[model samples]
Target: MIMAYLEAKGAKNVRIVPLDADNEKLVKGDFPSLGKTVEVAIAAHGSSTGFKSLMNGKADIWASSRSVKEKEVLAAKGFSDLEDPESEHVLGIDGLAIVVNPRNNVTQLSKEQLGLIYSGQVSNWSELGGPDMTISLFARDENSGTWDSFKNMVLGKQFQLSGSAQRFESSENLVRNVLQNEGGIGFIGMAFVGKSKLLAISDGPAQAFKPSQLTVATEDYALSRRLFFYTHGQPSNEYVTEFMRFAQGINGQSIVRNEGFISQNVESMDASLADDMPADYVEMVKGAKRLSVNFRFQEGSAQLDNKALKDIQRLAFYMREQMPNSKLLLIGFGDKRKNEHRSKLLSKLRAMAVKRELSRLGIYPQKTTGYGDFNPVASFEGASKIKNRRVEVWLR
Candidate 1:
């Protein structure tokens, strides 16, 4: 659809070509009405290649499934500051969805369970409440962005996948493999979920959340990530800038949704909670001042991600300098999953995790408590459950 729109807007002789070394598959389309053709190179060599390709002048635009890293930006400094605001564009958002055979009765999984499964810590389906059978694991090859996201978001930064895991270069192939194996589980972009049943994921013990427009757009889904486009510096070419503008514009975002990825235009935050929410839960925010930092756990793990770790450092500094005498209250919230008692306990743990981290930095909260599944700042079902799975430090 983007290609069709571009062709309609007069981009001629547009051909997507791949380097001979690229092993990923290719997807191509043609718009005869506007005399344009767009070929998509699908080699799963990871997003790092996109930045390298852009810097070398081999590609006009790098369609990346992940954000640009600091090192990649440094590598591209010779030609253009690809990291510059004018050069970077967010095309869409996607959630790395966990998929299982439709016949599998398991409806949800904790991120820890997934990490264990992929890392071969738990090998049998019965371990996760399924029938007695070996759990077949399928995954994208290391070259793919999906693999990168899954490794970092689901598996911890240092954890390596099990040697026995099957690796596929194409998401379509990976999904097909999963379809044929009832005991198989794999991760893929929401775009490729198709007939495969998507497992609702939980960060801790909270209710499982599925990948949906609401979740992915708002980054409530644990594996939700941004999709990007990188150009050499500010895209000096007229056509390049126009195409980017269109990609970020309404029509492009519509196409993004149509392609099964979440649109960037979706609201980032939710302002209201469910009507049936407890009055006290809703009132918790009435008087206490909210913190600028929102501390959430890494998907399924107690450890914080790099970003959250940095945020924690900054927050500790803020508390020491800005509110030295003010009593800090840490409120933890959880997604609606399991029973209220369990959810509340999970929420409390999340808050405690934040408090513990702050304590190491010499900042301690006056009190910390968890509110089970109440007062969501984002959708609780399929989107941004992370918004609820958070610890908010308030000034009391």
Candidate 2:
């Protein structure tokens, strides 16, 4: 969608050659800015196919809804580390919304309950305090990145999607089916929530949150995920590199928001502090607003992940433009640890890490602290627990 928008904006006499009845394989035109004919070939098969193409030298950019897998990184050893911040580009954010028929009264669910429902352990709506009707499941096909995210984030290793569930290749089709069945429940990207009802989802002890631009952008929403464009090392093709720059720039991010995905544009919103929030944490945030960007680390390590590296620059730019004189605060949180002091130290270190990065970009924060394990967004039991290790930005 972003590519098509860019082509329309900058290209003249654009031509699209169909790969099939539904997908276009080649888009070519004379782009005025580049002063040359540019042709881009896209294969919209699936995320896995993109990685496969990348490994074989058939694709310069692997556009994906999910992060590249470790196996894929190993298979593409010929290229630079696929997991490096240079090669892994986070293009946008998306929230995987759990949807149900609008008529259904259930408005929220915990992640464990969701796993149970999808795995057929709790097969009736009444089990969840809804109507007595038997639940019907709908899901994306296994090949879909959406399915992969849902499986990893929601189902984890303990549960498998029930065999009775109906699967569809298209989110719209799945949504349409869900809309027709009052007992139906399914998950789709936030953009596809459409007429179907969306459920506020909670992970671990975090309060249930509805998918919104703010929540998803902050990654406080339980199901939020990043959309990516992976290149082999730093892209050598000037056109490919240029296109990526455009995609991550203001005009491209605007297109992202318009297309119903969350752009990485930094914005501030009133903090929705939970009642269970620690007294000191609440006191610190008083009269302050939280930025939409969250700086998260690579699992168990204080090093900023690929997305956080990009966010450091975004946050710095935002500070200059929107809140140059505002009082800035950085608070970090970490997963539970056996040693409380170690947890606090590690969390503080994470915040300091973010502060150092911002300082280099000429944005100095006023105060930095760590809440340790006071608030967790996911259970410590699974890989998703990495969400707990993060630094949040706030402005007064």
Candidate 3:
């Protein structure tokens, strides 16, 4: 779904292909649309396999819906060999599912019940008040990306499947069989639940409910899954990077929701000046274009007061997640041109202070520079210079 979303965003040359880190005989691009062109290879496997392909250099974009694990990070022996090895990007979330046959009336199942179901201890449908027949089970294939994810989450080292359970090649295939067969249930990505009857699994009434963009957004849905699309460090091509930027934009998420997953609600504000940015002005600047705007700060200081911090934090969060490439120029000013020269070094220190705080919060590899008080509001010279003795963050 995420790969499809990117294609909808004018990423004309985008392609989704299967990949294998250890073997390529069955790992070739077998999907029909992928054969349309081999312009660039993007291996959108389940998260683990996607990372594997990324580390192996077989793919440009590694598509999956989970955060990279330490185990997987250790698996990146080859990714560090990239020209620029630190390139990593996180896109959006996909709500995971515990699907069952439409005929099954069980609207919600607790986490304990789910553990039992997967463990094979709860084998009969009648145990959960459905049919008298034994509950047939299925999972993704051994080499499947989803299978790797499930193993890490539910099964782990101690996990095992019963003899009666069956496995399929893909989630799409699994959903097809689960829908047609009675008393059969399976777990799948939420996007696949479209057109098929799905049961809502919940932990409690006040918060528990069916999975949707809304439920998942509010964290009311227990099965919300984080979807991801990774790249090997950062791509060397501008188009590949541009396509990634498009994927994180509103259009990509719109496609994600339209394709049957949940949509992300992006926060926005109309700025009167350089106001309404996240508390980290320098970080927020990275996400902003070269739009001219005004910002008011404390009367005599560059320090961010409590009230100003609130607005900046909101803007900064969105910027960091959405714009990974842009850098912010954190220029500080003094009361006058005379003060500017002497304040230049001090201003530089102030900008570095902001960068340090943001980097501590995990916004890495951003640059910051300071220019002393040369630019000020002409209308309010005295009062504004006091305000001008402030940090003016802008996009470069």
Candidate 4:
């Protein structure tokens, strides 16, 4: 896309050489739209090789899935300081999805349980509420950035993957293998989750989260990580700088969206109950301060998602230590489901669900109300309708 856009702006003889460390071949097929003006040759190795290529002046750009490590930054001091300003650019965000065969009945797993499974401490499906069978493990090779990120996130950097686990050179192969085995479990980039069942993950049994653009952008998904493009210092070349800017700009972000990753430009926020709410709800929270967090539900369900579960812990602590005598107003909003009455009722039910969760945390709401289809963050038919179905917290 970037190449095409540049061609549209009338640049000539453009070429992009991308060295991929993930071992997957990058086939830069013909782009008739761009009139074949740009050439992209992708070399498969590991992220380390990309960095090596950059330092040795063999490649112009290092497309890395993971951030440049400290040791790597030191190695490229002569030619590039990857950490320097304008040298590193974030292209997109990807949610590392935990996938299983469609036949697997397990819909959720806690982070600790995931750690144990990958570490070889839990090898039986029965231990995790699955049918009695030996669990099959698939993983990315150690050379890949996906493997490094998974190890750092789930298994500590000091821990090694189970010896029994089968490792693949690419995410595509790992996902394919998992799909074929009923008891198979693995992790892959969200883009590779075709026809595979994605598991909702939680820190505990209380709440679980599935990866979505909203969730991943807000980092509600535990495994959400940023994708990067590293250049040698700040590129002084006109074509390189323009390409980098194009990738970081709105058009480039559109490409990121098209590629099945969360665009860096995607908006994510914990909006207060104060804005554009009903007059009554606004009055109720007139003198109150809004917490930096809000509650959200799973799609089509009244249950809180994993991020809300963690937010509850922080809110509880704040209430106990900072505002012992304060009162809370729980205001819920719903999308247009049916008629006005049904929308209103559904909204109330959502608020009540939040109240129940607060009760579990030993905190009680002084008042609660639901405003259905009232103030929407986006159009009802737009992709962001889910943002409207929420409960906001206000302290008085």
lDDT of each: 0.73, 0.87, 0.55, 0.73
Clashing residue pairs in candidate 1 (N, C-alpha, C atoms within 3 angstroms): 24-43, 46-143, 207-337, 215-383, 215-384, 220-384, 220-385
- How would you encode candidate 3's per-residue C-alpha lDDT over 33-139 as one tens digit per residue? 44443244433335666666667667777776655665666666455422122344435545567788777777777544665787899988789877787777878
**Which regions in candidate 1 have their CA more than 4 angstroms from the true location?**
10-45, 80-82, 267-396
Off by over 4 Å in 4: 10-38, 204-207, 268-396
TM-score, one value per model: 0.65, 0.94, 0.56, 0.63
Per-model clash counts, in order, read 7, 0, 15, 2
Report how far residue 154 has shifted in candidate 3, in Å: 3.6
How does candidate 3 fare on TM-score?
Answer: 0.56
Order of quality (TM-score): 2, 1, 4, 3
**Rank list by lDDT:** 2, 1, 4, 3
Question: Per-residue lDDT for 176-250 in model 4, tens only?
Answer: 899899999999889999989999976431246787776665444667666778998778778678777787666
lDDT of 2 by residue, 299-330 (tens): 75678898888888888888898788897899
lDDT of 3: 0.55
Q: Pick the candidate with the highest lDDT.
A: 2
What digit string (tens of lDDT, one per residue) describes model 1 on residues 1-396?
446454656556544555667465544556577565656555446676766677777678888887676788787777777655566766877889999999999898887788899999999989999888899999998768888778767776535699999999789999999999999999999999889999988775344578876656546566777788888766777867777877776678778888888775422233334567667656764566655345666666766644466557656766676667877778888788868999999889988888898899998788888887775544464434556787766665
Q: For model 3, give the 10-residue run with minimal summed lDDT.
A: 22-31
Evaluate residue 336 in candidate 1 and report its C-alpha lDDT on the 0 to 100 scale.
86
Query: Relative to the unseen true structure, what is the C-alpha lDDT of residue 162 in candidate 3, on a scale of 0 to 100?
Result: 64
lDDT of 2: 0.87
